[model samples]
Target: MSRLVACLVLLALPALAAEPAPRRPVHTYSIVARDPVTGELGVAVQSHWFSVGATVPWAEAGVGAVATQSFVDPSYGRLGLEMMRAGRSAQESLAGLLAADGAPGVRQVAMVDAQGRVAAHTGDRCIVAAGHVVGEGFSVQANMMERDTVWPAMAKAFREAKGDLAERMLAALEAAEAQGGDIRGRQSAALVVVSAKSTGRPWVDRRFDLRVDDHAQPLVELRRLLTLQRAYNAMNEGDLALERKDTDGALAAYGAAEKLVPDNAEMVFWHAISLVGVGRVDEAVPLLQRTYKADPRWRELVLRLPRAGLLPDDPKLLARLTGAKAVKK
Candidate 1:
């Protein structure tokens, strides 16, 4: 029953279970946060309900992040972001929504706006082992959990953890699980992060949006997806470097992407191509060989690159790269 002072009043209200129960009782643990250094806003959640990712997490760049669960009402996420987008703070937006709701006592929701103001609510009618903790730039909340320690452990982890918004939020989720997470056990999870400022393009502003729709171990799969996202992020940086004609910078970025997923053929092939384009054929050979051995289609793709003006038209170089001809002294 531990909770922030603001939520005490809500807890004192009569239980709303007299009304019909929400069809989707998405009881879960979640956190909404704004990164102090990057100004990025994000929300992460794990639940026993199926596909919690689809309903629990919502965020808008330069506005706020929201997590709505327990007896979930998805309108909280949409309307909360709408309010924050219209200049309302997270606290103001959540308070207004709760005030107008017919059954606020059954909902669990948290929000963190771009400016880092955070607020949360855990309705009195929520199941046992339920509570919330609001910190400087974040709010950690949980309902129907294995223990009351879940949200506090989440808050502590997010406070002391290092890294960007996505990583820190993930740390909070991991901590919740370490405290015996959802009472019914894990099913689905989601993590979403948006830029500090909007780019006017919705797709571009969504930095890291990932979900594990259904998994026996949702948190573990979510972390793996995050790693893959980072690798692809490095690849994009490499592409940007190439556009800038910074060959050395491109190589460094590509090398990083390759190291992140050494077994990924796409990353290995691109790193090899970048190295060869820089006239570091010797360094490129091993990487090319690795990809070619894994799938002969990569060698075929290399052969087509010359005709597309992406590679030199020299037959000798192509032969040597494909391992058909020996490297010259």
Candidate 2:
């Protein structure tokens, strides 16, 4: 009997030593919020693990935003968006969905509606210091934090920061880090915001969508990229105005964009085109020449402008715009 018992004990010891029971996941949280003025929905998230964007940050252009994380089951992201699209308010959708989840103790989530209704949840099985705070149009949540104050710091930052939706979300992430974010340290961060227009074109629908997959300073890099995106957005607006023959609007928008990133080749090139469109051809000549000199293919395209119906067919106008030798008849 003693020999048999020893053999069983040895087998059990190896099993226990080789693979322990799985502990609940600790790193996860999300924020779903509305932009009070624009009725835009935005979501942002960060995690100490890679590819947080795949599980966090969900938004429908006209409905709402949802961030689902912490022992994350991606079903929350897809279902939450579906619920919002089906006309459920943020609070109702969150409560009903979470109540039915089999692993509610391990999940974390935040959600906000187009009308600014907000809701959040932090599961009991999450790590200590895990909690969330809901503000007027936003909520901040964190789990597995290095300290107890991270969520509050995020709340304060979101409320106090001055900027658009994406900037405010970034502030929250920054504040959380300052208050001891992610007990294990950071790896990924993401921001997503959709406009009220619902243009049905996803590419142009984003007011801001940026991700830092793995970075030592992901938030800082995210902020820099946001600034660049804003500059390009301004440039696109300027071009749209130019197309409508709104010269004053075009000039103002282009100037604002150029001021943001003065050395960008695309900005310089478009500014020259806008100048020509408004009959400021002489002022445009130097810029056009510089752009064409930098890339001679631009000169070939300029020569074809008249045939493309983008410019007048008159030889004098073509020669003045191109600064090229006129074709002899």
Candidate 3:
């Protein structure tokens, strides 16, 4: 092996031998689940630790999801997904990791495979009020919590919640907080949802990946980010429709995005630009006026688009949109 490869292998030996590895008391609540309807796999977590999102959750598009916390060995999240990708079931993967751990009693972990198989572990040595629940296609776990009811509340909320995988997992996190979350109070949170199947494109496979590194109300901040992400997702769809010359689809998508964030100048400006592109000058005028009213910079942006081919070079159309005469070159 190369020198670097040798060093990496040697470093990983401790984990293989079940030796005690350095870990943090990540004591937190989390969920791992597969959406039956969308085949999407996801993991969501919230903790009092700074940037808990970076350590606790792991997932693969066509394999499974893992959440490792409570004196967390991040190896569980990494190796667990590896095993699942290699064809092991979620339960088998969790069992193998637990068996190899020198200090399993201090760990809290959960997994949900792509096939909807579920497994979870709560170490007996975990802080008080620690526990987990394994439901159909999902698992919820928590440690160092203010109340033992947290995990149960999460399970209940997830089962009854409406919307996609991201929405449901978010509900679980919110429910945990409602039942008195981390005894130390919340600091950071993360949510990740991957497509049911791989498109051979990692970027395309991740439908939602959001994090609130440190916040007084991490879950609330996380939700706002989710909404913003949705609006951007709509904008992307509109762009794609424009490329395909599908005017109706483009309009619908831009309209959806505008409705989601009506106050967003960027989305409004783009929607107006799109309307003008489809020869709907009258329809574009009001949207352009609205955006120009919100920010004069948008009007300046219009004067530059013609040169970039984003808008036609027609002086009459430009004057109508900007309510100003175009200077002759």
The number of the candidate with the highest lDDT is: 3
Q: Which ten residues in a row have the lowest lDDT in candidate 3?
A: 1-10
Write one digit per residue (lDDT tens) for candidate 3, span 38-100.
899999999999998888999889999999999988888887887778777888778777766
Candidate 3 TM-score versus the reference: 0.92
Give the alpha-carbon lDDT of every model: 0.87, 0.77, 0.88
TM-score of each: 0.91, 0.82, 0.92
Candidate 3 regions with alpha-carbon error over 4 angstroms: 1-21, 327-329
lDDT of 2 by residue, 264-322 (tens): 66666677767776788887777777777678677666677667555567787777767
lDDT measured at residue 142 in model 2 versus the true structure, 0 to 100: 88
Between candidates 1 and 2, name the one with more favorable lDDT: 1
Ranking by TM-score: 3, 1, 2
lDDT value, candidate 1, whole model: 0.87
Candidate 3 clashing pairs? Answer: none
